[model samples]
Target: MTIISVYYTAKMTDADHKELLEARLADIRRVGDTVNLLTVIEEGFESNAVRSKNERNFSKEVNPYVRKSAVVGATGMMKVTVASLKMFSKREIQEFDNETSATAWLRDELEVKA
Candidate 1:
């Protein structure tokens, strides 16, 4: 499983934000396989308390830090939050309220039935 470990913090800049996203996308490209994007976030919501963010919005408000994933073309994450959901197509959208639910759903949905 392609697993990505991440921690969501409100402290970040647009450049740093873009850089991280690009890096993650590059990593995904390197794998070219279905992997789990495991993220250990703030357990709350993406706050807009970071500097140079509000005065200069990053084109979106996905908790600048967490938003990095979406910017990296991770549609799976893009459709996670209410604001970012519009960044993707609804063809095969899957959302789970919690990690446990998501894990089971992935196993059931992505894995073929015998």
Candidate 2:
């Protein structure tokens, strides 16, 4: 299994989200291993449209292939939205205020599966 960690430094557009996710998924397919995703959203989404689109895309298309995910650095509405989306994800999904806690949660999820 591999943990794919992505650190976001700037606001993410819809295309940026797709590109990053697809790149990671391609690597997972090539490696043929379970992947735990850790996304650190430092700057948030570019717009409400971008956030909604990405959320829909992730919940419908990308989440099934993921084993677990921990989203870090989300606060305010972002945190609330992410937390609410948990029902749409088949894999374990959680939000955190910091990378250390998010990474720890992902590791714990992996260990539990192991």
Candidate 3:
């Protein structure tokens, strides 16, 4: 499994966010198939219409490479965003309060699937 942190993208401009998304997509593709532990743990990580559209597209693009997925630091309204992503991607993305719990869950899930 790989842990990809995109929390730094919190509060970024739309253009910057799109650029980072492209970079992250490249990284994910390089890593190939695995359980992806995505950390979106940042206070200002809110999404707008444009960001939401980018994210939906991202979810689809990464769907083939991501064997399983989990996220941490999705508090308040971010939970809604994650839920929306989950539905759009048709991927069961489990949420955790912190990185430790999320990583552990991903590990356990991988073992079960194995």
Candidate 4:
């Protein structure tokens, strides 16, 4: 199984965030079915209506290409954001406290499916 990792850094502007999202989407399209690890360990998530909408759209756009997805370092409001994305995308996304565990879960999930 192919696994792709995408990281969101701390204190990103909306434009920066959108750029990363688009890049990830391109990777997903290129790779087809893939397991994804999204690390937001130091992300300073803020509530913004535009960003939220873009996130929802991204979730929808990437859903079909993602075979399994895991998120690391989602705490506080980030947890809520992840949950919302899962719901909106109707995709099962696992959450973990650290990247190692998240990657393990994603790998195991793909192995099981295989």
**What RMSD, rounded to one decimal, does every model reach?**
8.7, 3.7, 3.4, 3.5
Q: Considering only N, C-alpha and C atoms within 3 Å, which residue pairs clash in candidate 1?
A: none
What is the Å distance of residue 106 in model 2 from its true position? 1.3
lDDT of 1 by residue, 10-91 (tens): 4655555556655665565566655444433333324343522431232232222221221122222233442343354221
**Can you tell me which runs of candidate 3 are displaced by over 4 Å?**
88-90, 109-114
| Candidate 3 local Cα displacement, residue 37, angstroms | 3.3
Over 4 Å off in model 1, which ranges?
Answer: 1-7, 34-91, 109-114
Best by TM-score: 4
Q: Compute each candidate's TM-score over C-alphas.
A: 0.42, 0.73, 0.78, 0.80
lDDT of 4 at 9: 68
Cα RMSD of predicted structure 2? 3.7
Error of 3 at 18 (Å): 1.1
Alpha-carbon local distance difference test for all models: 0.39, 0.69, 0.71, 0.71
Worst 10 residues of 2 by lDDT: 105-114
What is the total number of backbone clashes in candidate 4?
0
Model 4 spans > 4 angstroms off? 109-114
